[model samples]
Target chain A: MSMTMTQKILADHAGLKEVSAGQLIEAKLDVVMANDITGPMALPIFKQMADHVFDKDKVVLVPDHFTPNKDMKSAENSKAIREFSREQCLTHYMEQGKCGVEHAILPEQGIVVAGECIIGADSHTCTYGALGAFSTGVGTTDIATGMATGELWFKVPSAIKFVLKGELQPYVSGKDVILHIIGRIGVDGALYKSMEFTGDGVASLTMDDRFTICNMAIEAGAKNGIFPVDEITREYMQKHSKKVYKEYQADEDAEYDEVIEIDLSKITPTVAFPHLPGNAHTMEEINESEKIYIDQVVIGSCTNGRLSDLRKAAQILKGKKVADTVRVMVIPATQKIFVECIREGLAEIFVEAGCAFNTPSCGPCMGGHMGVMAKGEKCVSTTNRNFVGRMGDTEALIYLASPEVAAASAIAGYIADPRKAGN
Target chain B: MKAKGTVLKYGDNVDTDVIIPARYLNSFDAKELASHAMVDIDPTFTQRLKPGDIMVAGKNFGCGSSREHAPLALKTAGVSCVIAQSFARIFYRNSLNIGFAILECPEAAKDIDEGDQVEVDFDAGVIKNLTKDKKYQAQPFPEFLQKMIQANGLVNYVNQKREGKL
Candidate 1:
């Protein structure tokens, strides 16, 4: 019997000859992670189980959400991880200056590798699947168990193959593609299934685009979203990855529970309206009928906060000023991305375009702190998960879009297509 | 283990942000998190829910962030268990790891109504609606997971294993 990439990785880790979807197997984890908020909670549970980590090198703790000590409580929360890392002598503890978001930094620092099984306490752990790793999110207690035992059980998930065809239209990025897919497939469409990207269109996507796609897989209730490693992935690995990894792919005969075909050229800059990522609309659809105004435009997060995303946004924002009524904030996903932005003068461009530049953090993406929304305010954000009250007041609305659309919308003070925005 | 509760029904794709909201996640206290549970969707949720109530929901319940806060809030708010047609993968594991009861039964989820009196027998893996006089078979927990929950969460379960007490 042929197996998908997910099955092959799980079978190897579990030391089984073969495994199928829905089969429960205990597998060793290559990397275990938790962010500040979840890590602090897991610490007490970890203490209850054991005083030390099972493998310090394998355990990674980073404080991205509410980091840099947003408040006394947040400071205390981060303090827990800091103390635990010191006590355990963990090798991968990312301090404030060293850390960005967990998802971006993990791969950037070569902590998350290809063909490995990773479990993070945060849900976006699926982001690493872009690198061909079998990664999933767990809760605090699950992190505690993984920390103590370095192993956890998984019920292998079936695969959903998304075959992409045609070239992406101008400014129609991976965010638009993912939002479009999520719109077609309801929020629960891929429940407990892997959404695997394939075909020529996927090959045309950059690693940044693939990361943006996989990062939002959770919005469609997918266990993980993955892309096969190709030359682009190998190039990315050469620069950032510390260790060599074996490339993994699904067999041509591998069975998929469902197959979805998407034409990239048919998609345009899209936005997920208030309340859900599934309520997606192309810019043309909204421009045709809706009269919407925006209060803020946030361009960042694990979804679209990489250097490539920043450069794309910069391309749209250069020599243009944001609308007087709308505030724009651009945050890099990782410090490395921020440094690269500075090196490339993207920071200067954003500031010249009247956008506020923030240090790398989850920031307004989680609504935990920084650039929070007010009641009745509307925001176009380049982040995943637009559920109500996500960015601030429950009355405030969030629109999920690509960084290009977000930047274009910032200039227009409402939802606008990047193609029409004066570049 | 057996439990009984009144049902509080929710709709599909009830995500974590609405479950606890990110604004209130600054604190690590479960009780504090419980105070604001479901307020975004139903402001009177905490006030209306009685202790040991059961939450019945449509498919893909808990389908957003992997924050344990969602399950922690429900459990802290005295929800004994959540019965749904399906659940988001992480949320399902989070609920089990926290020792909160969650049963997936499509028929029960479809048939159960709000304010229904429900009883669950974990050993028998069955959910009975006393108000409707209906019984639905639930997927039984595997032996290992059952032991983990029996030990009152993964923490205790792992502790026992380390000490050879399991």
Candidate 2:
């Protein structure tokens, strides 16, 4: 039977001849990860559930969310992971400087490979799907089950195919494409379904762009999002991957629940207004309709903190100062990305533009600390979710946009289009 | 198999961020997390809610983030069950893994009101709102899932498996 890429991967992992949506199957995992926030909780649950980890090497723990130890409690939480790693002899535990955001660090370190099943105690675990891997997020208890047994049950999810066509205009990117889709689909349109991106337009998206797109799949309630393995994927894997991996694709006659054709040329820079990623607006609408003021601009997170994103933000910030009324916070997704930004002089450009460059952390994005919003204040962010009170102060508003839009907004002290901002 | 409680109602898209908030995530203790459950959305929630209260909400309850804290907080705060029009996938799985009772009954969600006296029969998949005197049907759990829930979550289920008690 012809199968979608998701079905093919699940069937292979579950040791089945074929599988369909809604079938329950227990499958082995190639990798399972948990961050500090979830790791502390999962550890106790794992200890209660089993005597030892199912596979020490396959379990990875990264303390990125409250890294550098936000408080004594955070320090204690991180210490639980460190001690568990020692007790279990875990191999992939990452500490400060060595650790980055789990989603970014996993792919960069080659921990997630094509056609493998990966699970993390993080909603953004879908980010790995960009590399042609099948990945999804689970809760701490689910992570505990995966840790104890190296297996968990999955309900096969129907898939929605998005065939993107046409060339992207200047300032338009993968972020715009995803925002446009979310706008059309609403936050729950693809509930419990896989979102597969295909077509010639995908070939034009860089690895960074692909990562950004797949990372936000969860915003639209997708189980996972994937792109087929093409030359771009192969090249990225060759450079970063250590183990051999097989390429997988959906069969020609694979069944799909829905197919959406998107014209990239029709997309422009866009933003998701207060409280929901599905509340999208075009750059023209936001800039021309009214003056949307902002008190801050944040340019980092698993969603848009790659080196390419940094370079673009810096390009826009070049020779321009951040508006005196607005504060800008720049964070690289990982230590490696931070190094690259510094080496490429992007760090210097940001500093010269009066933007504060912070160390790699899930900082401000999760509202844990570093740059939380004050009541009634507004922020333009490159992070994925804008759910109410996502970054502190329920009354404060968050607008999600691409790096280009965020950078320009930082300079304008309000929501502004990149085209209108002087290069 | 059965639970009775007063209703603590909420609207659609009650995301994880507001359910427990990230500020309180540093602690994993269910009790600590519980103290703040629904505090942001309903400031008097912790004060008004007593043990064994049933939570009814509109569509997509627990929509953002995969943190189990959201469900754990609600469960610890004396929420006997959550009946919603729909749920985010991760939240649904997390609630089940933690042995929390959650049901999808659009009719019940629409028919029930805040402060309603309610009773649920887990095995029969029935929810009764005594205040409104309405009975609503829910999707029954499959046998396997029912067994897992009966064990009070995956941890206990795994423990039973390890002891050859399955």
Candidate 3:
């Protein structure tokens, strides 16, 4: 039987010839991950199951959420994960000075590669799907179980094929593409299903773009989002990974529950308004309406805080000054990206533009700390999820947009179109 | 398995962030987490919630994050079971892994109102609204899920399997 890419990977991991949608099977895991928030919760349960993890090398832990010690509780949370990693003798544990966001650093460190079955306690673990891996987020207990057994049960998910046809417009990136798609399909559009990106347009997106797209797959309620392995993927793996990797391709006759065609050229700079990632509006739509002003602009997160994202924001903010009314925070995803930003002079550009360039952290994306908005405040952010009170005050409003739009909005002190801002 | 409770109704996409906001994620204390359950969306949720209360909501409930804290918060806050038109996959899996009961029934979610009393029969997949005198059938759990629930949760099920008792 013809099988989709996800099905093929699942079957291979499960040591079966074939697996179909909704078929429950026990598959070996290539990696099991947990962050500070979830890691602490999983440790006690993990201890209950076994004295040691299934494999020290395979169980990865990162304390990114409240790292740099936000408060007494957050400090304690990070301390638990640190102590557990030492006790377990885990090879992949990432500490504060060396760690970035879990999703961003894992790939950069080459710990996750194509055709592997991976699970992380953080929802954005789906980000690894950009490498053509079958990855999904799970609860702390699942993480604990995977760490103990090196295997977990999964119901093979049916897939929705997104055939991308054209090249994206200028100033439009993967953030816009995902925002546009989520806008078209409500938040639950791909619930419990694999969102497989295919077609010629896939080659047009950069690795950073693909990462941005896949990172927010959870926002669309997808089991995972994947891009087919290509030259770009191979080159990325070659550069960062030393481990041998496998690649899987979908059968031409692979079954998909539904097929949605996306014209990439038609996708413009888009933004998801306050309250939901699915509440999207294109730059064109926002321009036609009343000006939506803001109090802050955050240009970073696991979603869009990669090197390219920093460059995109810097390109728009290069010589421009942020509006006096708006406070802009630029956070690079990882320490490597942070150093590169400084090397590339992007940090200077941000500082010159009056933006606060902070250390690598998840920061304000989940409202853990740094750049928290006040009540009645509004922020234009490049992060994923605009759910109520996500950033800070329950009354604060968050507008999710691309880094370009975020920079432009900061300059204009309102939600402004990136395409129009620089020019 | 059965549960009966008063209903606390909500609308579509009642996300995990709102169910238990990120700000309070530092502490793993059950009671502290429960104290802030649904604080973002409904500040008085803990005050309004009582033991054996049934929470009902529209489509795509628990729509964000993989935080088990969300379900743990609701369960500890005394929500007996959650009935929704649909649920986000991670949240669905998390709820079951923790042995927090949840049912999906569009009709029941749509017709159920706040202050109504409802009872659920997990084995029979029935949801009866005692206040409205109406009944709705929920989507039954799959065999594996039913087994997991029977074993109390994923951890227990794993333990049982290791002991060759599953």
The digit string of per-residue lDDT tens for model 1 on A1-423 reads: 788888888898999988988888889999999998899999888877777889988999999999767889988889889999999999999987766988889988988878989999988899999988898888888998899899987888899999999889888899999999999998988889998888888788888888889998888898888888888888888888788687788989899999889999999888999889999898889889866889999998989999889999999999899999999989998989998999999999999989999988999998987799999999999989788889999899999999999998998988888998865
* lDDT score for residue A408 of model 1: 87
Query: DockQ of each model against the real complex?
Result: 0.84, 0.81, 0.87
lDDT of 3 by residue, A1-423 (tens): 999999999999999999999998899999999999999999888887899999999999999988777999999998889888998899998988787999999999999999999999999999999999999999999999999999998989999999999899888999999999899888999999999999999999999999999998888899999989999999999999998899999999999999999999999999999899999998888999999999999998899999999998999999999999999999998999999999999999999999999988888999988899899999999999899999999999999999989998999999999898846
**C-alpha TM-score for every candidate:** 0.97, 0.98, 0.99
User: What's the CA error at residue A248 for candidate 3, in Å?
Assistant: 0.7
| CAPRI tier of model 2 | high
**Candidate 2 on A1-423: residue-level lDDT in tens?**
888898889999999989998888888899999999999999878888787899988999999998888999999999999999999999899888875888888889888889998899999999989999899999999999999999988988999999988888888777888899999998887889999999988888899888999999998999999999989999999899887787788998999999999998899999999898999999878767879889999999999988889998999999999999999999998989999998999999999999999988899998988789989999999999888788989898999999999999999888988877887
Judged by DockQ cut-offs, is candidate 1 incorrect, acceptable, medium or high?
high
Candidate 2 local lDDT, B1-166, one digit each (tens): 7899999889988899999999899998999999999877898998999889999999888988999999999999998899999999999999999989999999999889999999999889999999988899999877778878998888888789779997
Model 1 chain B scores worst on lDDT over the 10 consecutive residues at B153-162
Name the runs in model 3 displaced over 4 angstroms: none
Number of the predicted model whose DockQ against the real structure is largest: 3
Measured against the true chain A, the candidates' chain A TM-scores are 0.98, 0.98, 0.99
Candidate 2 wrong stretches, greater than 4 Å: B162-164
Where does candidate 1 chain A have its weakest 10-residue lDDT segment? A240-249
